[model samples]
Structures are given as C-alpha cells and as structure tokens.
Target: CAMASLWMLLVCANAAAALLVCLYLWLIAWPRWKRETRARLKVADDATVVAFFHPFCASGGGGERVLWKMVHTLAQLHREKKRSLHVVIFAQKGPKTPEQILAGAEERFGIDVSTEGGSGGGGSMKIDFVFIETELIDLLHAETWPRFTMIGQSYGSMVVAWRGFQTATPDLYFDTTGAAFTLPLGKLCGARCAAYVHYPTISTDMLAMVYSRRPSYNHDSAIASSKLASLVKCVYYFLFAGLYGVAGAFANVVFVNSSWTRDHIEALWRLSPAPTVLYPPVNVEALA
Candidate 1:
C-alpha cells in the first residue's frame, strides 16, 4: 500500500510539473504576445480591459444571452463612470469576424453589444475577439480526458486559459464557462478574476453518488460494483473537492446561475458574502 501510494504521488507530481512547464513557456512569450495583440487590435494603453473567457460566446445559447447582456451592461455602466472599457472575448473557435459575431448576437438575443454599431447603446466600450485554438478548447471536453475526467478537464482548462493570456492581459477576467481552474490563471496574470459558475466542477451530489455506490454517467457499473473501486473513486472525489475549493478561493467574485448552484458554490468555496445568484439573462418579453 505504501509503494502504491508512492507511485500515485509520483504520477500526480509529474503531471503538475508538466503543467508548470507549459505555464512557464507561456509566460516567457506573454509580454511579446501582449504587445503584439494590443497593437493588432489597436487597443489604447489606458483602457480597462474586461476579458470574458467564454470560448463559445458567439454560440447564442442560454449562456450566450448572459454573455451579451453582461457585455451591454458593463459597457453602459463604465460609460456612466466615464471610464474607457475594452471588452475582449476569448472565443473557443472563430471563423467569424468580430462584426459577424456581434451581428449574430443582435440577431439572436436582441442585445446590441457593438461599440460602433450605432445602436444608441454602443458607448465608450470597444470590443475585440481573441479566437483560441480549437485543439486547446477540446482539452476541456470530456472525451479528451476519459479517465479522471473532473481533474482532467480542470487542468485542461488551465492550458486553454493560458492561450487567452498569450493574446492580451486584461484588467479584469470573467471565466463565464465555469472554468474554476482558470480563475487562478487570471489572478496570476494580474487581472481581477471572476466567474459565472453554472455548476461546480466537483459537487457534493457527485460525492454522494459515489458513496451510495450508484452507477451513473460519471461512474460506470464496473466502478460501482467493486467496493475497492468505489473507495478509490471516493478518495479521488474528496481530494478533487478540496483542490476545487482552493481554486475557487482565488476568484474576486462568483456569480451563480441558480439557487441550487449558489448552495453548492457556497458550501465548497465558503466565500465571505457567499456567491451571488445572478441568474442567466433571459428575454421573457421577446418570447412573449
């Protein structure tokens, strides 16, 4: 058992070292990439940058509504403060141009987030789209990490978020896709990290499932039937839960989409005021 423990420790340590090496290489290129990205986008030096780390912001899903609404609201509020705001979206994959994405948002959500679209709502906020590589985005997908998916995707997200840092460093960052792993990355880049957590990466419900020895999507019959396997999964989930709590602690603010989400986030993260329940922006009037 002691030797088994040592082997596991070595594996985890090496994986962590690999991630660190990637981060180091990314940091080495960051300053040069930042300057180049800023110049290419024509971003002013003094503008407050709010980066939304949603690789699929232009997808126009429920999350996209929230994304566009936040863009509009933040733009409007900053205009009232007389501060120049630059909203940069780290889109997962983009063949569409920024104008095309903005047009899609307006067409789908009826929200005009364009600074130059002459929507009367377009204020002092300028918009830029930073398209991330498709391969990097796929790292967050479940198929990429079939075994130990929770931890796999958590570390995978850190890599994808690093790609965003290689583009432009923002004053503020919102990991709108529930990538809690990226919160620390944002903080490391000197940005005030924020998250709109739709669901926790590891939840107490998942823990309970493993405890009850239930076979479900996350756990197959083989693991559920074997007592030893269930015990191993329990330990994995417990350790992950602890690590997730630590990662979540780095967020400057957390906004959840529902009361259930709020309960889980609070239980895990234990924030001072608790994570605020900022439900997704849905257009009821438009539907009617």
Candidate 2:
C-alpha cells in the first residue's frame, strides 16, 4: 500500500509538470495560432450539402430541438427546389443505444421523426442513418460514409476529429458548442465550418466568476461548491487549450447561438471570426 501510494504520487507529480509545461507553451503560441488561422479564412463554395451531426443523446434538450428544426427547415427548402439534401447523423452509442436516442427525438421533435420518409418530408431525399460506435478515424478509414456536409451539436461536434482521420473533407461544418476547436472541422471536413457557440470557454469574466471574484457569492460555501469547480475547469482548459487551438484557428466561419456565448468565444479565443447570430427557432406556426 505504501509503494502504491508512492507510485500514485509520482504519477500525479509527472502530470502536474506536464500540464505546467503545456500551459506555458499555450501562452507563448496563442498569438501565432490566432494570426495563422485568420489569414486562411475565405468564402467556400455552396454546392456541397450540409450534414448535421446529431449525437441524439436520450435527453431531448434544446440542442436536439435546434437540430431537428434545422433538418426540417433544410428539407422544406430542398422540397421547394425539387432537389434532395444529403445528411449524416453521427453518434456514439453505449448503454444508451441509438434507437433509444431516436425514440427520444421522436417523442420531443415529433412522433413522425425517422431516418426514412418521416417528419412529413417525402422520400425525395435519400436519408441514411449510420449507427456506428467506431472512432472517427475508423470511419474515415472505412471509406463507406458518403461525403456530405457535416453539422454537429454538443457531443456530436466532438466527432469532427473523425475528419482528421480521413483525407475527405466535409462541404460545410456547423455545431452548437461541445466542439471546443478540435480536428479543424473546416479544413478536415473540406467545407466551410460554422458553429453556434453557447459560451466563451476561457474568458476573463468566466475566470473571475470561477475564482469566486464575482459579486454574487460572498460566502465560501458558494465558492467551494461552484466557483471553485469553475476555477479548476479553467485551469484544465488553460492546460489543454492547444488540443483545440488548431481546430479553432482553421474554422472557415463561425456562428454563435446566443449573444452571451458569442462574447465568451471572442474574449477567450483572443480572435473572433465574423460570427453570425442564429437564434434557436420554435415551431410556433406548426402548433398554430
């Protein structure tokens, strides 16, 4: 037990040293990453179809609403043009199966939601549902997935790393947070990448709030419960910023889901690309 404890201490010490070194490197290279990424931004072609990456977590939340709405809206647009749009819903499955997630989406998004001719949209578009738990690299290596535009929300966006595993590029990439600048979606997906950010991950204001320097929490209890966690998260982010730096720098375009999120994305990243506002849409007319 003593030897095990000693080994654990050594492991922790090594981790701390590595983290410190990485943090220093991130600080020194942050400016360069920003400059190089910005210089490469230019408008891309629109011929490529948009593939919205849907992780479809069983929790039917706002992000899923946004995705379903987007899919429906795009389908409506395509139907009007008498053309079809291609989409791929990328997800990871574990105890919560994809069928369960799909059922949840149906329950929330609509009962008619299916990969087939559902959602009141006709079979004009060929929709394929790929249920794979393989790494993004394996998906790329398999060469079975159709080259379509990629859009991801939350966890789905994280899979953009799969693009890096393959030589193919997406026509367009869009995500609402949980993407955190990995895999250079724009470059790797071979499309214009745009994301709807939910928050500024590494902003001074966030750090302040995290450090319990905010005005709201005067007691140590609040600090210990929440602010301290935020501070610790910020520290982790600081050390790991480089992991996502390349992805952020290589984004062709970006959009924030809310004003609050946009501010944070800008402040924390040190460079804010021309961000567009896309308020979450509601199906009011349908209800009416």
Candidate 3:
C-alpha cells in the first residue's frame, strides 16, 4: 500500500511538470502566430466588445440553453446596432470542441454562427470563440485575449473562477451553477464576479443526501473502503471549505439562479462580502 501511494504521488508530480513545460512552449510560439494570424484576419489589436464566456457549456442543459439564449440576444442586439459582442468559450479539458458546440447551437436554435480557434481569424466585427484548455496555456500566457465577461456553468464555472483568481485577468466572472471553490477565487481575483447559482451547497442542507450520515449515500468511497482514507478526505473537505470562504469573498456580485442556491452560499459563507440575488430571466412563450 505504501509503495502504491508513492507511485501515485510520483505520477501526479510528473504530470504537473509536463503541464508546466507545455505551457512554456505554447507561450513562446504564440507571438509569431499572433502577428501572422492578425495580418491575415485584418483585425486591429484592440476592439470594443461584450462576451459570454462559458468554460463548461456542454449540450442542452439549463446553463447551455441560457448561454445560447444570451448569444441569440447578443446577435439581435448587434443587428440593431445596440451592442457589440465577442463571445468566447474557454472550455476546460475533457469537453466538446468549439466547432462541436457551434454545430449544436446551430442545430438547436437555427442560428448560423462560426467561431475562430485562435485569437485572430481575421474578422473585423463578429463574436469569436477561443477554446483555451491546458493545451492553450500559451494563449493564456500570451495575454492577448481581450477583456470580456466570462460565464461558467457547473464545474466549468468553478474552473473559470479559479483561473481568473490565479491569473488576475481583467474579466467579469459569471457562474451559473456549481459554486464550489469559485466564489472565494473570484473575490481574490477582484473580478466583477457573479454566480447564477441553482442551490445552496449540500453542507447547508440538513436533508441533503450527501450529509445523511448514513453510510449508504455517503460519497466517501475512500472512507467506505478504508477508515484512514475517508478520514483524510473529510479533513480535506473541511480545509477546502475554508479556502472556499476566502475565494468567495472576492466576488463583487452573487446572483443565485434559485432561492435554494442563494441560501446555500449564504449559509456556507455567512459573512461573505458579495451581494446575493435571485435573477431569473423573463420566459417568453417561445421558451415553452
């Protein structure tokens, strides 16, 4: 068992090292590509824009639906000369590609929009989606991405908040759900962050299946397997909760998707500095 533990630790350390190395190489190759791509695309370095940034915008969930709705609204707004939007999807690893998402949107909404993979697709006025996962750390380090609003749903949202906190990017972080460690990260980054949370965390819910104390529903498989490992995760969660408090305090705005989410966030961080709300959008007949 001890040898197995050592092997796991070694594997994780190696993976971290590889990621760092990849990030380094990506940054070095970015500038030349940026110059050539921009020249080809004919876009000036800076442009005014509003963006819908979704890190975890997958197929047809509430968050995905809301994001597409936002995109449609932005498209209409731009048509009427009311606004200029440059949507970006900084999706995480282990998700659909930008093209895949674009195809999905077209199929569902009958809206035809295409996104560029890199910073410059040589377009003058249009929304662009850049998929920046671990592979695009070079783009991230290049710091060429324009400032825009970032919207994340579920785990993607939490990751966006965490990345914002780590990189200090000038962005507005919006979370639709999965408000785990993100609030604290948003607060730390000092970004204009908001959460459209669906419900308060299970920690705040006495009747939650997660905290039933009955062994059956407990997700602590490590604990069920071994008392020692379970104890470690418990301690980890407790420590993790403390870190969440620190990160959440950085958010400037907190808009819960439902009353349940608001209550959960409030309960978890009773003294959080961010404002809370239930900001549901108007439901048109088309939505039905």
| TM-score attained by model 2 | 0.55
Compose the digit string of candidate 2's lDDT tens values, residues 1-288. 999999999999999998786565345443343233223322122223454444443456777787766666666665565544554454444466545665676677673334454322344333334344655424333134332112112124445444321222235555543465543534443456666565544454544554554544322344446766556554654554433444565655666677876666565554437666778766575788
Clashes of each: 1, 10, 12
Candidate 3, residue 149: CA error in Å?
Answer: 28
Candidate 3: lDDT over CA atoms?
0.50
TM-score against native, each model: 0.84, 0.55, 0.54
Candidate 1 per-residue lDDT over residues 1-288, each given as its tens digit: 999999999999999998896577557645466567668767666667789988888796898888899998887876675666778888877588888898999999999776773212224578877788898888888999889898888887888888878777777899888888888778777678888988888888998999999999888999999999999999999988888888888898889999999988888886423698998887888768
Model 3 TM-score (2 dp): 0.54
Q: RMSD of each candidate?
A: 4.5, 12.9, 10.8
Any idea what lDDT model 1 has?
Answer: 0.82
Candidate 3 per-residue C-alpha lDDT over 1-288 given as tens digits, one digit per residue, 9 for 90 to 100: 999999999999999998786565345433344344345434334523333345556555666666666566655555555543344344555566666777887776555565433323233235444444564332322133322111112234455544533322323455554454555444333335555555544454422322333344335453446666555545555555555555566555656666666666776655565445645544465577
Select the stronger candidate by lDDT from 1 and 2: 1
What is the C-alpha local distance difference test score of each model?
0.82, 0.50, 0.50
Clashing residue pairs for model 1: 55-92
